[model samples]
Target: MSLLFSEEEFQSAWTELDEPQLDGGWELFTESMGVKIYRLYDQDTGLYEYKVFGVLDSCPPELCADVYMDLDYRKQWDGYVKELHQDQFEGRPAVYWQVKYPFPLSNRDYVYVRERRDLDLDGRRIWVILAHSSPETPCAERSGVLRVRQYRQSVAMETDGARGAKVFMRYFDNPGGMIPAWLVNWAAKSGVPNFLTDMQKACSNYAAYCQRK
Candidate 1:
């Protein structure tokens, strides 16, 4: 079976998340919602990458994966997401996301190719989901909406003992505009924790909903 992302790319991302280099440009920023967040400067692009990690108690790895993969449930929890839809790009699964921005800033949207993989790492099961912006997708930029030209995000989840899931995420996006660097940094520091909290709650809710069905 063919894969959307090459094996090398997947393995590289997984390794990076599993054993991140804390000394090289990555700085611990804040801890909130039981998650530790880090910020790193991308010297090449002059942008910052946000790295987040935490463990959710009583949530299995599979449940965490299910919450992330389910797009319909995303709209229920992700407040910034204004629109989301599944699409295909070059015969690969892709998604279009229109996100709402704060006032005076235009909304941003992205078309990204998403892929999921389950792997065995040192006798432990890990699930990884990756998404990267794809300009090749034939999606027109909407009026009053800025197209995110550069964006990549990934999440890795693995079981912690018998009843917990450890989650790690790395995200970076260049919202092309004259927005001040300070504002972007502020959002990254303040917004990511809230996002993760909401995501954790959503996972819990989804698990309960599934149990009922």
Candidate 2:
């Protein structure tokens, strides 16, 4: 199948994150270390779509964007990534990822297409990355893992002076099983912050990593 979405979809995502309002069923989920996470519940799926806006202090937009797109380097830093690799199906590039989950819960995997864009809007440079699962994928589900059939994520970043960036992200995925609401809520409240913290450390070490490679 073709890539799940197009450029217009990514543009729309950037616009939505550019100016997020609290009144649009988006409630504040958490705020810490200059980042704020928000969530909007979907009545139809009984799931939550999360949005995050924040300043990545002392991290340049270019570096942040590059780090996000550097799949080969991602495994060196991101522990949650059990398996990640790129593939070509029908002449289109697709990414296959297996993510680790907490004990007692099965691991989850995804097959998606991703794109990166650089835009200049209103004289401001913005970097965007978009990803969504394909409808009819060639990847088969693993025996002990669940496939996240419905998954999507978008991120936008812009310079916030010489050494910082204003970052925004939207994330959602159906884990595809009987998962408890409380567990999901707890994961968000804690996981997001931890992820950001790790990313910052990774960014700081990126230059040396590149030098070694």
Candidate 3:
């Protein structure tokens, strides 16, 4: 028992969330039942400003499951990013998960892998798996697994005669998840100044990246 509506209709339905604004930002506002919703707003270098949104079940295990599994998820289309601050994603691909079953229901499952083209490296990617089992039994949940696993990666980026490496690991397990407070606070922030240092190193070491050809 579900229904669909045009963007205007949907927007009209929730008059409260609406606000008069310019074209560079968007917001979410709602006080509803049975479902949750969010919105996005944007403006291109030379395009009209507009917005879009989504609605899902309250608990969202199903949504989370799908986002965490879909192996070829990145191929069909780069998933949409829900949070801009997390990924700093302006137009980056948003990888999502997909689930097969619920938690504490299955146990004979092996972990799986997915490639991370998102980083431009051909072999980097995050893996997916069940994080835990039901307390009552060692069985899996009917909701299956609500987790994703990503492999660690390291890259050597060079620019302006400097060489350095970028560690493609989560600030934690899955940087795609929540970043540690220090990342934004100061430690990671310091990396910005070192950009030229890496570039200079790479430029000075050009022969290292080449094979005498």
Candidate 4:
């Protein structure tokens, strides 16, 4: 299948993987699970931006990337994801993800086309997986769920010898409805570190699972 994003879009996204500079408004939110999390104000979206970086010890870069691409097994580790499936839009690949939310809040969903590539940056091998919401893909709205209209997330993994891999992520999503900004920021701060920790364990478990299969 062909890529949903154009060459320019891919290049711009790849360039930003070098850890984009945060303006004066950005703040060092928190550090946990060996990952440093940062937050910044997004003038265009009127929402707080988030970036996470860390290294997963003993997990190879390719193995880490495989865990993400293996969509059918996501539920085995990703506690936030309720449902996930794949489809095609005009012959391009697309994914639908339904996320779980706490009580009194409606669940959120996203439909996006994900693309991955491997490149050498300064003699270091890196694997990048990028996903952005595509509302143009025909999908039926789910009851009691809010569709995320704007979302973009990416993962960058660089090899750290045979020991492990260095991982970086940049994510932004506008959960539709009357949620408070403070709550949103708080969730990003508290949930991300735990999420990364889960991911590290997931990678290791998945690698073992694959070998046994």
RMSD of each: 2.3, 2.2, 19.8, 2.6
The CA root-mean-square deviation of candidate 4, after full C-alpha superposition on the true structure, stands at 2.6
> What is the C-alpha lDDT profile of model 2 across 106-207, one tens digit per residue?
999999988888888888788888888875767777899988898899988888776888888888877878897667767878888898888888889999
- Write the residue-wise lDDT of candidate 3 on 11-113 in tens digits: 2322322333323444432223221222232122121111222222221222222333333332223222221111112333232334232243322222222
By TM-score, is 1 or 2 better?
2
> Which is superior by lDDT, 1 or 3?
1
lDDT of 4 by residue, 119-194 (tens): 7768767788888898988887899999998998887787766688887788888887889776887787767788
User: Candidate 4 clashing pairs?
Assistant: none
Q: Give me candidate 1's TM-score against the actual structure.
A: 0.89
User: What is the alpha-carbon lDDT for the whole of candidate 2?
Assistant: 0.85
What TM-score would each prediction reach against the true structure?
0.89, 0.92, 0.19, 0.87
Candidate 2 vs. true structure, TM-score: 0.92
Worst 10 contiguous positions by lDDT, candidate 1:
1-10
What ranges in model 4 sit over 4 Å off? 6-20, 43-46, 89-92, 121-123, 211-213
Winner on lDDT between 3 and 4 is: 4
Rate residue 65 of model 3 by lDDT. 28
CA deviation > 4 Å runs, candidate 1 = 1-3, 16-18, 89-92, 208-213
Tens digits of per-residue lDDT, candidate 1, 83-146, equal 9989765565679999999898899999988888998977878888888998888787899999
User: How many Å off is the CA of 18 in candidate 3?
Assistant: 35
lDDT of 4: 0.79
Best-matching candidate per TM-score: 2
